[model samples]
Target: MSAIELEKDGGLWTVTLNRPDKANSLTRAMLEELADIAEAAVDARVLILTGRGRVFSAGADLDEAKAGLALSPVWERLSGAIAALPGLSIAALNGTLAGGAMGMALACDLRIAVPGAKFFYPVMKLGFLPQPSDPARMAALVGPSRAKLILMGGQKIEAPEALQMGLVDRIVEGEALLDTARGIAADTLTAKPEIATGIKRLCQG
Candidate 1:
């Protein structure tokens, strides 16, 4: 099966991370596929990123990392592709999102996560530095102090705490996560394309 799955429902397109057995960990092939999908999805009115199982993504595959592969550049390209998408972007976080996987959610314009979902950034613990742009982007949403607590202190933020810190835009109950995301996607699709794009551009700038 493909590592990523794409589906279009009206104007909303969903890109799902499908490697459930690995907690949806990202591999080089998956990263390339994600970038390609994001680039091709610009025409959709909204794009929702989600995962198939209890973990949104476990981050880069360890085997790839141990073999001397640098995944940050690939992640940067994927995040950039998502950010540049003209359509409204939403990260429908299904469960745990950790390490480099945080970048995917950060790149989205909006985020809706299940109540028990967890967010973690362990680059410091892993003896790696986050991409230069990551800290700034996170700080923009949750201020510099909290960003440092997360990145430097390696604190794990649960959904409620994440909501309070503005790391996630909204919190929905377990089974209702995708529905809430679809509702938001519907709202975004209702707006004029140019207006939505302009608002996103304004907010990001």
Candidate 2:
């Protein structure tokens, strides 16, 4: 089966990390594919990132990371593509988000996760720095010290705490996760393209 799945429903593009057995841990090929999808999503009015099963992603595949995927530029490329999207981007985290997987979610315009989800980035203990834009994007959402607590201190944050810290925008029930994300995208999906894109641009400013 494909590790990544892309579904296009008109201007609403949903990207799903599909390797549930692997906790959807990203591989180089998966990362590249995700980057490609993001880059090609320019015409999308809304993009929703989510995963199957009980975990969004556990970051790089261990074997691949041992071979240097940990420092690959594709991570940055994928996140950058998502961040540069003119449309609204939402990370509907299905479950825990850990390690480098944090980058893509951090780049999204809004993040909403299930109540059981946990958030952590353990680059410090793993002896690798986060993707180029991760720290800044993370800090922009959660303040420097909190970003430090997760990155430097390697503290795992629960969904409620994540929302309180401004990391996640909302905590939703597992069943309602994707529905909520879709609801949030409804306005963007129906708005005139230029108007939606303009609001996104202005907010980023």
Candidate 3:
């Protein structure tokens, strides 16, 4: 199967990160596919982003990253494109989420994290910055100090702590994450499509 799969269900477009053996770490080709999906829209009422097996995304694929960061540019553009999609978008964090992958979650309108899963960004530990937009997005959600602490600390937090820190909008059992995400996406998608995109963009500002 493709590393990333886009499935249309009625009005919902479920984007699954399908690299189970690699913990769903997205690649350059995957980014291209996602970009195409975002640009098309094509009657998607809602978009749910999730992962296969156990991970939403374990950030970059270390091997590919070491091989000169294969899909960095594509992913950067794709992440921004997904953020501005017309459909309601929700992140379904099934397991460990980190790095640029966490940026993907931040781009979503809402995040539903499975309980006990770890949420963190350790870019600072690697002597690099979080994605340019990450701090601002995270800060908007959890406030500045919390964002600084979490991102700078470079330490992982469990679901309960992540909730306390406002990193997760909702928490559910792993088995329930997709259902919760779809319910949220469906509820939000009830709004007029154009209005949904406009309001979401303004709120992001």
Candidate 4:
């Protein structure tokens, strides 16, 4: 099966991280596929990113790290693609989010996660810089103080704390996570397209 899956319903497109056995850790192939999906989703009015199982993404595949391959460039490209989407972007984090994958989530306009989900960015503790786009995006979402707590302090923030810190927009439990995201997407449809797109781009910056 593919490491990434794309499903479209009308103008809503969902991009799923499908490597459940590996906690949806990203591989080169997966990153490439995601970038392609993002690039090809111009017709989508709303894009939702989520994981297939209990974990959103554990970040880069350690095998790639061990092989001495540079994954930063690929991550940069992928995050940039998601950020550049003309319409609204939503991240439906079904479970925990950590490491490099946090960048992709931060790129989204809104983040809705399950109650069991946790958020962490451990790059500094792992002795590496996060993807270039991560820090600013993280700071934008939760402010510089909270961003430092996660990125530099390597704090493991649970759902409640995450919501308090503004790391996640909403915490809906179980199947309600996706349902709520779809509802938000439907609400966005009521806005004027050009106005919504313009406001979205402005907020993204």
**Candidate 2, residue 30: how far the Cα is off, in Å:** 0.3
Please give, for residues 81-195, the per-residue lDDT of candidate 4 as tens digits.
Answer: 8888888899999999989888889888899999999888888776788888999988887899989988888899999988988889889997888888999998666677788
Better of 1 and 2 by lDDT: 2
Candidate 3 lDDT, 1-205, residue by residue in tens: 6888888877788988999998888776776787788767546778888888877888878877667563367656766877777677788888889877888788777888888679788777766667777788889888898887778877677889888877888889988888888777766667777787777768767
Which of 1 and 2 is ahead in TM-score?
A: 2
Tens digits of per-residue lDDT, candidate 1, 26-83, equal: 8888988998888888888999999998899989898986664444488888888887
What's the distance in Å from true for residue 202, model 1?
3.0
TM-score of model 2 (CA atoms): 0.99
Local error of candidate 2 at residue 35 (angstroms): 0.3
Candidate 2: residue 106 lDDT (0-100): 95
Provide the lDDT at 60 for model 2: 93
Residue ranges of candidate 4 with Cα displaced over 4 Å: 202-205
Q: In model 4, where is the ten-residue run with the lowest total lDDT?
A: 65-74
User: What C-alpha RMSD separates each model from the true structure?
Assistant: 1.3, 0.6, 2.1, 1.6
TM-score of each: 0.95, 0.99, 0.89, 0.94
Candidate 4 or 3, higher TM-score:
4
**Between the candidate structures 2 and 3, which one is better when assessed by TM-score?**
2
For candidate 1, the C-alpha RMSD (Å) to the true structure equals 1.3
User: How do the residues 1-205 of candidate 2 rate in per-residue lDDT, one tens digit apiece?
Assistant: 8989999999999999999999999999999999999999998999999999999999999999999999999999999999999999999999999999999999999999999999989888878888889999999999999999999988999999999999999999999999999999999999999999898888878
Top TM-score hit: 2
Q: What is the TM-score ranking, best to worst?
A: 2, 1, 4, 3
TM-score: which is higher, 2 or 4?
A: 2
